[model samples]
Target chain A: MNWTLLLEQTLNGFQFGILLFLLAAGLTLIFGIMDLINLAHGSLYMMGAYFAATLTKWTGSFLLGAILAIPACMAFGMIVEMIAIRTLYTRNHLDQVLATFGLILFFNEFVRLIWGPIGLDIPLPEVLNGSVELFLGIRYPAFRLVIIAVGILVAFLLYLLVSRTKLGMLIRAGASNRQMISALGVNINFLYTIVFGLGAALAGLAGLMAGPIMTVEIGMGEGILIITLVVIVIGGVGSIKGAFVAALLVGLIDTLGRSFLPDILGLFFSNDVADTAAPAISSMLIYLLMALILAIKPQGLFPPRGA
Target chain B: MKGTPRIIFIVILMLGLGVVPLLADYFDEPFYTVMFSRMLILSIGAVSLNLILGFGGMVSFGHAVYLGIGSYMVGIGTMHAVEDGIEWMANGFLQITLAIVFSALTGLVIGAISLRTRGVYFIMITLAFSQMLYFVAVGNERYGGDDGLSLYMRSDFNGLIDITYDNSLYYLNFVILLLSLYLSHRLINSRFGMVIRGAKSNEQRMRAIGFPVFRYQLVAFVIAGTICGIAGVLSANQTEFVNPSVMHWTRSGDLIIMTVLGGLGTLFGPVIGAVAFLFLEEFLSGITEYWQLYFGPMLVLVVIFARGGIDGMLVGLDKWWSRNSTVKNEEID
Candidate 1:
């Protein structure tokens, strides 16, 4: 393998992992704090991409589009939470699944109605469009580097918020024992609204950032959402740290396997056979990893301590 | 009046279904005959899924995989016979038995692995496994890839009814649906089903009582998967096509919706649910292409407001009617 190509792929994997972290973080938090499974989380991401695409088109500024989408997602999330998801707290996971599933259909069709099915594309800004020379031999896109920087900064902020703030303590407490948190006179409903909105904003951020790289379209969130679910399963349910570690690991494995598995298989099989078989195996790789992980640790790698 | 009203209602419903195809023939609307045939086939699927989801409390989000595998069995079998001149694969009984058996084996393996995980993990893992198969289906260039292959004619049953004829397949599907419903009804009431139901109600308790909960659950899971695999044969035969979309996660979701909408754990609920849900789809899509928007919220309403679903509602109405009559009996006495 060419060293430069390997490094570039690694960076690409890292960038992808970062986006996953953004999406999975919210999902884990919602699951952790609310004990709710929100299948519509991906719909939030889809709406964010659509909102960002629309805003950027109108404003002619990518950064502004992304910035505006965060709050927009939060507002929309709060509305949805009140209208549909709030009542699901008392019901079983099956009900939550169906209700949110309904939300998915509604949102997908609603987007189709507004966007007219033909997908939108976001162009990278001119300044970040150029390639940056990292060293004498390697070059990478400036936009990707910016994404890395943003992802890390967001990660840092999330760490600080979760670790240092009083609100974070409340969130942590709420996650473990909602009854105790409510006994302490916390408005559990308000807290849930905040948490749901926070998760939605995080997903929206991921979506807005992803728009320029991938097509902004209906049902786009679903493809990545399953991967995110695997990340959570690998990382351990309701653990942000696990989500982070798992996302990166999944991204690296997926990326590297896609690039090199065929090459490795070529050593044993014919080139034609290797070409055909590699992709199918690589596509199954993450799920296999998740299954293996679950078989060993059904609760996941880093399940939140003490419930 | 002495017996439960829901049973009375079910008898009426089945009788109604039995006669409708006959009525359709007389009315010259083979269209509705075909429609009810499709519903019956789907009801078989929904009913099988209900065995697991409603009765056994295993929320298998990937149930449609069985349907797709069943479809592909017939699709690929016919393709082999017609295109490659492979005679053995084209035998309908062999194809169906292999499909059901293969899907049951897969169900066993999948059940063995997935049953270890509970709640949300089970749901996600099942969805993931099904999706994994879906992608494989998408990538297989031999079987038409993303665009599905078609069966020129329905599977043949030698020296029996000609299923390729329009209403023959419909009647056959009705018989199969009736058989499946009867089998499921018996299975649910059998001692084995009692163990499964006991486990579903309280696994810890079931384990304490020395029930091999996992084995029972796995068996139930396999049975449900096999039944769904049979339904998949009907679906393939009904549509005369097989594609990855049949196994799509959304289709699995649709199965769940039908089960829930009908009433979990109650006999005949899923069939009604399938009819209501599919008929609504047919009606709404005819009115506007954006039918899903209405469908999505309507599902939400059913989940939110009608937790008992159509079957549960009927049961509740029966109870109310019985209570009113009992009061009259007291007054007369």
Candidate 2:
């Protein structure tokens, strides 16, 4: 394999992983702190993309549209929480699953009603449309570079928010002992809404950034949500650090595996056979990795304390 | 639980289904017969799902994998039975036998790995496995690949039963549905049913009482898969086609909806759920282009308010009616 191609794929994987990290962070936090599984989280991500596409078209400023989607998503998430998610907290996981499933059905059709079944487009700003030289002989798309840089920045800021802030402490405490924190007179319901809102915003942010690169479509969020779930499962649910590492690992493996598995398989199989089988096998690499990890460490690579 | 109301309900439902074809003939709307037949086929799927999800407390999200596998068996088996270059490999009987048996075997393998995890992990793992199978189906170029495989002719029973006709196929589905419902009913009341329920309610207690919980759960999983595989055979016969989309996890989600909407842990719950769920889809799609917009929110309200589903709500109504009648009698006295 060419070294330059390898380097480019590595960067692609990094960018993809960062987007996953954004999705996983929110999912893990909501799951971690609230002990609730929110399948509708992907719908929030889809909403963000739709919002960005719509606002950008209306205002003719991509940046302006992206900025406005955060609050819109947060507000949307909280309203949803108040209306439906609030009822799920006291119920069992099965009930949570079914209810959120209903929400998914609702949002999918709701988006269809507004945006129609076709995908929307987010026109990239001229400034971020070109490629940038990453190495002497290699170039990378400027927008993808921006995504990686922004992802790193978000990761850094998130690290600070969780480690050094009082809200972080409350979040950590809530994840650990919900009853204790509630008994201590902290407004648990408000905290939950805030956390859910924050999670929605992160998912939204990921959506907006991803819209330019990927087709901003009806089921786009769901396609990525499965991979994000794998990331969190590998990283250990409720642990941001775990989510980050696992996201990166999954991203790298998925990208690299797709690119290289066929060539590797070619050594043992005929070209026709390799070409046919490689795509299926490589696509399954992450799941196989998950099964392996689960077999050895059923709790995952980095389960949260007490989880 | 008292059986009178349930018995009355069953009698009415069976009668409704039995006369649907005659009614359709009178109205000259044969489409309703096909629709009811589809509902019966799906009811079998929902019932099988309920066995594991409700009674066994194993919320497998990939139950449709078996359905897909079963359909593929029909497609591939029929292809082989023909005078193809590949040689006539097997009879339709053997193919179907393999479908049901193979699905049970697959359940055992998948259950062995997945049942080790619980809650969300189990859900995700099952989903992942189903997707893996979906991709596999998508990759098989010989079987039509991404486009899916179409059957040349329906599975021939060698004149034992004529399944080429829609009405005949509908009757087959009806008979199978009744047999499965009866089988599950027997299972639910048996000692095995109690153990499964006991494990669901309290796994640790079941284990503490010297029950090999995992083995029992795995067997239940296998049984569910087998029944669903049978449903798949009916579905393939009904549709005259088999595609990779058959195993999509969303369809699995629909199966779960049937179980939950009908009533969890109840014998007749999933059948009611399938009917309600399908009937609503039929009604809404008839009225609006964006039916899911209405249907989705309605499902949410059901989960929120009718938490016990249509089956539970009906039972509650029965109890309420009996209590009110007794109170009236007391007042008169």
lDDT of 2 by residue, A16-111 (tens): 999999999999999899988888888999999999999899889999999998899999999999988998888788878888888888899899
TM-score of chain A of 1: 0.98
Docking level of model 2 = medium
lDDT of 1 by residue, A185-226 (tens): 999999999999999998988898888888999899988888
Please state what fraction of the native interface contacts candidate 1 reproduces.
0.72
| Cα DockQ of the candidate 2 complex | 0.69
Off by over 4 Å in 1: B1-5, B331-333
Clash pairs, candidate 1, are: none
Best by lDDT: 1
Error of 2 at A8 (Å): 1.1
Error of 2 at A178 (Å): 0.8
Q: List runs of model 2 lying over 4 Å from the truth.
A: B1-4, B81-91, B328-333
